[model samples]
Target: MADIVVRRVDLGYFVRPASETGTEHARVEPTLGYLIEHPIGLVLVDTGMGRHPEVDAHYRPRRIPLTAALRTAGAKLDDIEYVVNCHLHFDHCGGNPELAGRPVFTQRSELSLARTTEHTIPELIDHPGARYEELDGEAEILPGVVIVPTPGHTAGHQSVVVTRRDGTIVVAGQSHDNASLFTGDVLSQRAGVGHHPVWIDRLLAFDPRQVVFAHDNAVWTPGTSQVSAS
Candidate 1:
């Protein structure tokens, strides 16, 4: 397999309501998506924020429409061959409708919740041309790209693992919200001191060269000396 390129798609930002964040003051977070340029085809991870009056009033999202975002990433909507939504949250799968007919890979459990519960925007999940390829668990959607369950933010949340000649990259969409949180989890796992997700071990096994997140711009790299949160 040829070396794959993972490009960050800036979906824009949003302000989290204080009540929802459990913080005294609302916090601002970036909504990001990833585009994996593979030899076989392009795979998009997470769309942008979905529109809803109540959600808008709560999140106060400043969205960069999916088309524009993809353009900035050096691609177009029509160029995307497959879609992998880390989870079906409104902010994550917002642009799913646009890529209808393309196989949108999602966890079966996540799809069930998104359909039966008030999980995400209804239309985003079951649009006119929506085509979902629900997976029961971990599956390799591409030659060197694997989707592993990383539930926490959501029950069926997952992350993408891309292995290149140099090293591995994990697109941990909202897996830990930010790179710092993910780093802390890694540190905790190392020292065996605090609670961390079981899937953290799975990700660690990959020894990722860099880990990116959906809500934070920072990237997590190995080594405490090389750790970068800014």
Candidate 2:
């Protein structure tokens, strides 16, 4: 048996749709890429991005500081075999075209919604060379790595749970960008923030030793303290 290692890649920021005007406002979003090294093969959590004509022409995905970050993690576009995006938003799945023709796993619902909804990257789900999966339940993406459905950010959003030897680590993706969301916010709850109670409860129930976000450098580990990328 071989061990799989999950590496978080800081892919930098992009503007998000503003909360009020529905206008695109730059928010220094924390883009992330996860690398899973397994004996079976190299599985990449998210492709991050280089550039895209469709996105550039339409949504205007901002500059990426990820080339250095991806190299630092020893990952090249060609090195990736499998891709699992927590969800398919323009910023998160912008890199999907780079890994075209590869096996990309995403929530089944995300794939379907990408068709009519503006919330996703169209190329991601309908790429000519890509193999997409709209998974409904848990599966060991790699040996010790499992993908969990923590839908909230969108109906199909999910988090990746890695059962490591030291302890379990949950890659909470967009379910909650920071530790603050977990504590419960009345305003956000009323406005329908992130994952619902069930999804949030499920991640907490696992009691993962560490929780990491796809965007920023924030980290939450159980029985410990809070940490962020400063």
Candidate 3:
């Protein structure tokens, strides 16, 4: 099998407070997406943010439309054969509507919540010709590339695992806000000190060489215990 190539797509940046309290001040964070060049076809993870009045008022995301973002990654909207959303959050699945008939994989639970709850903008989802392939659990949507449920930030959140000759790379979308938090969770699990999700164990089993984040540009290298661009 050919090696799967994973490229980061820079969607744009947004400013938000580090903590809920205004005392912490605001921090600038980048919204990221991933483009996977697979032998089967091109697969996209997350579609960047969508535009809405309420959404804008809240996040105030400086937008980079999916088309522009994809282009930066040497891909195009038409080139994407399938999409796997980490979750149905507005920032994660905003471009889902533009995908139309393309297969967009998401956990059934996540889809149900997105459709019913006030968590995300309704117009961003259930758009014209929206086709959702809801999964009950982990699924190998593409050969050597699988979607594993890693619920932490959200009940039905998922992450993409791409197996390469070097090692596995996990595209953890908002799994723990940042790679450091994920590292802490992993360390806690190792020590058996506190609660950690079952999915963390599953991810550790893969022995990932590098773990990437959606909002963070840093790559978590477990062996070195350091973050790098990689």
Candidate 4:
């Protein structure tokens, strides 16, 4: 089998309140996507922002076209055979139209919610010929790549886990806002903190070598090993 390589695609940045504290002004956060080059085929995790007046007013997103973003990662729109979204949030699946008819993997519950509720921009979710492979739970898309249901940020949110000879890397799309939050959860589990999410335990079972985030560039490795962004 050929090696699996994961590359980060910078989709552009957006400004939002730095924290839950509503008083403060906005701060910029990077909107990131991932390209997984696998022997089976190429998998894309999250498409960048989509265009909508409401969405534009809310997040104030600065986006790079999906094609250009893919090019930056040494890939192209035509190269992606499959797509997996962490969730159906406007910022996450904004570029779905670009992959029309492609098999986009997402949790079934997420699709249900995206359709009925006002959670995400409706236009982005139901683009023309949007081929979606709705998953109920965890399922392996390829031999070494699996989409795990890691619902916390959203009801049907999912994360991608890529296993390699070296170790495993979890492309945790907004699983937490950043690696630090995920690290805290890991530490909480190690300390036997009360009543953690079942998915957290499931992710811990993978014994991941590194964890990547969508909003932040920092990487969290096993133990206290962390690769901070420069």
Candidate 5:
């Protein structure tokens, strides 16, 4: 099998409240998305930021609009053949409404909540061109590209597992806020001490070459060291 390429898309950033960050003061964090350049087709993960009065006041985001961001990544909005939302948060599914006819792979539970509750921007979820392929569990949407349920950030949160000939890459969208938090979970799992998510073992089973995040720029490698940026 040939190698599959994954590129990072900068959706933009937001100011997270101190309460949410567990810090003395608020912190600015980047919102990231991934572009999987598979031989079969282009798969876009997370669609940047959704806008709303309340959400805007809370996160105070500075978005890069999906088309512009994709352009930076050498892709066009029309080129995306499939969409995978890590979860239905406002920031992740911002561009989904524009994606209209494409097949969007989302967790059944996540979709349910997004529709029934105030989980995300309702317009984004039930727009005119929305077509969702709700998955009950893990599914290999494309060759060597798998969507595994990593529910913790949300009940239906998921991470993309891309297996290439050289190694594997896990696009863990908000599975933990950043790489450091993921490293803590990995260490906890290894020592069998701290509380970690059940799916931690499953992700480790892939022996991922590198792990990326939605809110952090750093990439997590197998060793103690970290890749500052991709």
Candidate 6:
């Protein structure tokens, strides 16, 4: 079997506030994910920014070009076989139309909250692909890929564990949007204390070769893997 490989595709879209980085835009291009060589074929972690810039520009979504992001990775929407949402935030699921009829795996609780969170932006939840198979509970999506429940950022928020031929890596969607958070920054779970200490413990217990986060500009390469970034 060709070992599973992971890539962090910077689908340059939104950024943090200027106060955070001091640059004119002071933003970051959030990354989408690619989990390769899994038994169920290929899986795209999140669909980057969707097509709603005009609708929510006045509010607060600083988006980049998603089409260009995918192009950099040498991928088209059709290349993704299955889609897994860390959570259904607008920026994350925007690219789901790449496979309108395909199944997107999500948590029922997260979907419910996404639908009725009241305070969340409505545009994020109004996707045409919400008919996803709501995760009943923790289980495997592929022989080597398992979805681990890591609540706190949002109910039913989960991460994927890709067990490759060499070592395992955990795609912690929002668990650690950046390395600083996982390394102990109080602001780690910025989406509202949605992170639990237990989840990190469990994830590390598995001893991942690397930790990939959804919105960060960096990656943590474990001392163990030659193939992963340190």
- Give each model's whole-structure lDDT: 0.92, 0.69, 0.88, 0.88, 0.93, 0.67
lDDT of 3 at 47: 92
Error (Å) of candidate 6 at residue 95 is: 0.9
Measured with C-alpha atoms, the lDDT of residue 219 in candidate 1 is: 89
RMSD of 1: 1.3
State the lDDT of candidate 6 residue by residue for 116-169, as single tens digits: 875344654655654487797677887888888888778788998888767888
Off by over 4 Å in 1: 225-230
lDDT of 1 at 104: 93
Which has the higher lDDT value, candidate number 2 or candidate number 5? 5
C-alpha lDDT of residue 190 in model 6: 27
Ranking the candidates on lDDT from highest down gives 5, 1, 4, 3, 2, 6
Better of 4 and 6 by TM-score: 4
For all predicted structures, in order, the TM-scores are 0.97, 0.80, 0.95, 0.95, 0.97, 0.77
Any idea what lDDT model 1 has?
0.92
Better of 2 and 5 by TM-score: 5
Single out the weakest 10-residue window by summed lDDT for candidate 1.
221-230
Model 1 lDDT per residue over 171-221, tens place: 999898778788888988999998999999999899899999999989899
Q: How many residue pairs clash in each candidate?
A: 0, 5, 0, 0, 0, 6
Residue pairs that clash (backbone atoms under 3 angstroms), model 5? none
Distance from true position, residue 2, model 6, in Å?
Answer: 2.5
Measured by TM-score, how close is model 3 to the native structure? Answer: 0.95
Worst 10-residue stretch by lDDT in candidate 5?
221-230
Clashes in predicted model 5: 0
lDDT of 5 at 152: 88
- TM-score winner between 1 and 6, please give it: 1
lDDT of 4 by residue, 30-123 (tens): 9999999999889999998877887687778899899999999999899999999999998899889989999999999999999998768888
Candidate 3 regions with alpha-carbon error over 4 angstroms? 18-23
**Residue runs of model 4 more than 4 Å from their true location after superposition:** 18-23, 225-227
